[model samples]
Target: MQPDVPTASCCGEADAYFADEIHVRDGKTYAIITDDRPDEPRGRPHVDIGTEIEVPDHKLKWDKGNPTGHGIIFLSRNRYVFCYVQPGGA
Candidate 1:
């Protein structure tokens, strides 16, 4: 989905999240990734398009209690990637 909503997370208020492809529409699967860490500031985090990453299973937490079943992918002690799973999804 193309999320035009601005979020406090990610790059703060400077830019809105979901400007790039996050999850494929064909399936529920999404690529786990880390910040690309550019040599210079780009105002927002960047991820390599085809670079899929792997983290501990425990880090991927799914919140079934939420209406959207939103989950959090904890990448590090202070970094995390929020997964917004749409309703009616597995």
Candidate 2:
């Protein structure tokens, strides 16, 4: 399951470079995982918005919005997971 369309503060607009992954935790709160490829070490994970991820055997794609892109998680046959950024940050 996915949360409501997060406010602009959470999810940014959509774009080609705005690819991301939707992570689901026991059907509760949702978080967006992205990959980061900084020239310098950020001393953190490389997962940042727009980073391509391998989502199991499921197929993913963009859903809606502009400026930033959102990922739609396809779980199984009819199950689906919607991933979005919480805005303010990319």
Candidate 3:
């Protein structure tokens, strides 16, 4: 139910930033949305969205976000995708 809320306002290592490792059609179920990272807009500019990434054992769970962990994947160009990953405790 909460996933329906837009993530445009969420950035940095925040929980309300993203959802769990739930899959959805980019152009269908829910549109992939993005917003400038106010704290670090140019953070990791090399990475893009939709890129697959392996999680580091220590870097699994993020600071927030349901304690479900999150990871970043590269996208088309200078964009980074924020998504869920297997929780470290899992």
TM agreement with the true structure for every prediction: 0.30, 0.25, 0.26
Instruction: Point to the candidate with the largest lDDT.
Output: 2
Q: Model 1, 8-59: lDDT tens per residue?
A: 2322321212212235444444543333335135354444434443332332
Q: Give the alpha-carbon lDDT of every model.
A: 0.32, 0.33, 0.31
Candidate 1: how large is its RMSD? 10.2
Q: What is the C-alpha RMSD of each candidate to the true structure, in Å?
A: 10.2, 11.3, 12.0
Question: Over the stretch 1-90, how does candidate 2's per-residue lDDT look in tens digits?
Answer: 123433312221121123344455554444344433451343322334643334431222234333333333222212233333232223
Q: Give per-residue CA lDDT, model 3, range 4-57, as digits (tens).
A: 223333234432222223333442222222323442445433322332333322
How do these models rank on TM-score, best leading? 1, 3, 2
Candidate 2: count the clashes.
20
The candidate 2 region of ten consecutive residues with least summed lDDT is: 8-17
Residue 80, candidate 3: C-alpha displacement in angstroms:
14
User: Which of 1 and 2 is ahead in TM-score?
Assistant: 1
Q: What is the lDDT of candidate 1?
A: 0.32
lDDT for predicted candidate 3 compared with the true structure = 0.31
